[model samples]
Target: MTTLADIAETQRLAMLSLSQRMADFETHLKASPPGADLTGLHKDFSAFKEHVWGVFSALQRQIAELSRSVDVIEMRHRKKFLLLGGVPESSGEKVPETVASILQSKFGLSDLAPSSLTVCHRLGSASDGHARPILLRCADSKIRDLIWRTKTKLKGSSYVVSEFLTRQRQTAFTTARKLFGVTNVWTMDGVVNVKLPDGKRRRVFSVDEVVALGVEHGKQLDQEAPPESSSNRKSATSPPSIRSRRTIKKK
Candidate 1:
């Protein structure tokens, strides 16, 4: 019952039906006109992006504040700590004994109590078998302050001592040192010091403070003594007028 002529006629009818459907779809799409306001959409998206960025920026600020607060707390906890560098390390070494010996012999602090040594140990993760800095904690705040003040005495010796400060403060101190030179910069109890041209020391506690000090130091170096003031220079350069002691009588 299915002949060649019948198959040809069915294929023709299917192709005609598909063409009609496509034409109808095109007509519908043209009628709809897709009137989406692309400009308005872009503006809305930009606003949304700006709002998101604002929130992200606020989060970044909060994270920075959190980091700063944590640093402050940690620095407060480490207020009684000191770092001793360039000390030789040996296997099975007793840190407390070595530190005590150094303090007594080098610093001449023979009266320090044994109990005042709260903690003492070498710090760092060196695998190359090098000596690391020693972290020593004292029980008394006054003793710690004294040690910090006297650390400068270790300058010529093989061993050197420094206050244990927060990483941020340490970085600021390094920056200050680079800016102001080694002789003019020092740190004590997390405070940075810069010796000015006037031979006075200024205390700086933050990176911003260090930067401000650097700017001030630069200004001091670049500044001249106001060019000696033009009036003062002219007066000094001009010869004194010869005045007659006797006044002439008027006719």
Candidate 2:
């Protein structure tokens, strides 16, 4: 016996409840400092509960619609999942063996993996030198931060990350040109290759550079040592190490 009128009334009530709850949230946010704990206050608000329920209901409806659409597409295609593996036969023309070797040996990519797994590839242009450009395979904030730190530590190198391959490379090349004011900055598709000490090659980028910088910094600290006056140094070098430790323990 649920009529359209009843549904309308229910929706109107939900909207009013949600609005009141949002107003309470806004008031709390205004009163609280940026890092203050407001969990108890949030839980006490009735309006917040209503607002959360409404959001959950809306999400459920959208998910149901998406499920139906996916079912239809799968029925039509006679496939449960879409396949994005392998290069298109049309573009499978002979490429350099070096490119293949680099992808497998350095980047640790499987020969028959899906195209999506590769993320992006940048082809070398005539203007850029022979140095292979870096390829970032992951899409995440942590990875991005790691890469940025690495780039900054690399004394004379730079890097960029973009969700889109075309735009990222173009931006990288442009930025490198401006930063170094030099045209010899390299660009290439996929991974950047560096020669190893044992006559082998490896793929490395800003992420690796950051790690190397951290290790180098640690070594430098060890070599330079610390001034004797420092509490840390005194504790380490003191004749009565146990007494110093006990004093700190008492404190």
Candidate 3:
């Protein structure tokens, strides 16, 4: 607002103040130990990562436990169910009549009414090219149990009935069969069994159980060449039972 010399003096003073501030900033930066701070930050992050992993691990364990519980419940529900395989498909066939006949004749189930069966069906579409299995659900668990026990009676017959097992159990059954042969491996109400080294059979319900057996005694079993007897092999491959039903259970 006054003379040019006065204005220039003010400008010079302002520039000096800014330069001092810049110098101070540089000095403060130089004094600070950036590497030490970085190390502390890294340590903090590592601790956080470990804590997260621990939480995740616990969650995984809980989920695994829940899955096992669900599997057990499902297997229990299927305990009263059976699968009848190898019934020929025909058009205009009386499915209920056929079922009644089979139960009366082949299964020797007397005085069973149509209402005694809760569910019955051939499982899938005819386009699958394979013979559809029959899924039979009885009103009483006792009836189903009786039918399941009589499966051995149907041995070498054109029709066969087997316990309905979950897919995982089925896979385990197949694995046991591969290792232990047909006779040594069988299922009771979806519970898989394999003959042990001591001539005693042990129940195996999970794939892990079968895997452990293979890991522990696979070599010894193979060395012993414990092949299935000819009778058992014949029974295993023999034609499965056929019951009249549209509800086909998956093998």
| lDDT tens per residue, model 2, 144-213 | 3343333323222122222212222333333332222222233233222333224454332333332353
**Cα deviation of 181 in candidate 3 (Å)?**
1.8
For residues 12-79, write the lDDT of model 3, one tens digit per residue: 56656755765675576567785645556456655765675576567556655765676788788777
Write model 1 residue lDDT over 107-142, tens digit each, in one string. 788977555687777765543656777777776667
Q: How do these models rank on TM-score, best leading? A: 3, 1, 2
Q: Using lDDT, give the best candidate's number.
A: 3
Residue pairs whose backbone atoms clash in candidate 1: none
lDDT of 1 at 140: 68
Best of the two (2, 3) by TM-score = 3
TM for candidate 2 is 0.18
Superposed Cα RMSD, model 2: 23.3
Whole-model Cα lDDT of every candidate shown, in order: 0.64, 0.36, 0.67
Models ranked on lDDT: 3, 1, 2
Q: Could you tell which candidate, 1 or 3, scores higher by lDDT?
A: 3
Q: Choose the strongest candidate by TM-score.
A: 3
